[model samples]
Target: MRLSLNQWTTRRWSVAEAVDGCVRHGLEAIGLWRQNVAEQGLAESVKLVRDAGLRVSSLCRGGFLTTSGKAFAEALDDNRRAIDEAAELEAACLVMVVGGLPGVQPGEPLTAGASRDLAGARERVAEALAELAPYAGERGVKLALEPLHPIYCPDRAVLSTLGQALDLALAHPEEQVGVVVDTFHVWWDPRVFDDIARAGRRIASYQVCDYLHPLPEDVLLGRGMMGDGVIDFKPITRAVLDAGYTGDVEVEIFNADIWAADPDEVVATMKARYEDVVLSRP
Candidate 1:
């Protein structure tokens, strides 16, 4: 496995610290979150990683294209900045988590007319992608559309399957856009293997993490480490490898417990797990 640690998996580590940790653990790549980059300043963040000889596998995200009016406008502007940041960091792609339904702010209630409409939200995401694809291409950043689990469709991402993500990416040129095959999100899909083959060269990023039980109250933090869950790594990994994806294999977990552990220990465990499981098959 071409291992890369996503910054979110060790959220407490700064960009500088994360890079140092990666180097310490013999990792040569990392997936950065926007907030962490902003904290270190874009130039400093880029320098920090480059100075350490680490590759920015992908930038965490650059989408939320479902809101209307000012919210939508702000999302576009933020995404534009995200594209610039990804280019500056020499990242391979900008992962996009296209937003879900409208009017459901974090703590707020859904408004009257802003009911759940999966088709409408997905259409809006496609339109937004059409608008952003050219700009991203100009900046030399491929837009990597990631389909979250169907459970997230109601409140997080409208693109809830790899096939749907590929549909949107195929609308544009291959160089300008691609899909992300994240194991935790797509593992339960009945057609995951076929979709991986179908994704082929359009697959820009491959992420790994296990699916654990005992759902947390905050479901976003429920992801498990690679070998701790029920996911069968060999088949999924073989499918991705067979698809001809040569990019970094990133470990992106959201478990609160993982975040609470020592960053260095987390990376060590991640490396061990990747060696034992992810790399064991392919």
Candidate 2:
């Protein structure tokens, strides 16, 4: 499988800088974030990546189905715009970080029972996806539902398991909805191998990253580098490959430590580590 890098790892760097770093390290693709693209001008960013001969594996995000009324409408509009941007960028898929909690916004005040409303939040996510899937399908963009780890469930995403993501995908199969399996998130899951088999070809994208410890955030890729973490990546990759997935193994680490360092160094280290730990396996 091909190797890809997520823009989040180099959020401090410009899109051009991130593209340059990834290309220099011989990565096959890069995942772009909406905010960075907005800063660089979508068209110009697309051109820069294409000129570097790098594939746009998937756009970082699109989807916040928390509130109702104007807020919800605005979120839909934002998602539509994101779809247009992904289409223009020629990204393989648009990754969806589906929202969580009824009134919870990132970095906002937490509600007393917010965590208990998981079922409701999941329902809202499903409804929102059902509403947006047709539009994404019409544009020939696959909407990849990424289940964030349970750590983020109370505030970020309610879908915290690959099995749950597959359920959502199967529910909207006609709409081309698929799953984005991130190793950092689901590596420790007991059902990971089974879920990968179930996901089969519907696995739109695969992300790779290691974590030193299971913290909320700030985990570096090298610390969690493939085999270094407790996960058995070779078996996981084998399951995904056996299930017929041929997408890029996109490295996505949200480590503040790595971001503080030079972007080029991060890319080079990640590429070498992925090759030694993930790619070197059968």
In terms of TM-score, which candidate is strongest? 1
Q: In candidate 1, residue 164 scores what lDDT?
A: 90
- The positional error of residue 193 in candidate 1, measured at the CA in angstroms, is 0.8
Give the worst 10-residue stretch by lDDT in candidate 1. Answer: 103-112
**Candidate 1 lDDT score at position 153:** 75
lDDT per residue (tens digit) for residues 128-170 in model 1: 8888999999999999999998767767788889999998899
Q: Each candidate: RMSD to true structure?
A: 1.4, 2.3
TM-score of 1: 0.96
Best by lDDT: 1
The per-model lDDT (C-alpha) reads 0.89, 0.81
What does candidate 2's lDDT look like per residue over 148-214, in tens digits? Answer: 8776776677888999989988977633799988887888799988999988889999988775555
**Can you tell me which runs of candidate 2 are displaced by over 4 Å?**
107-116, 214-223
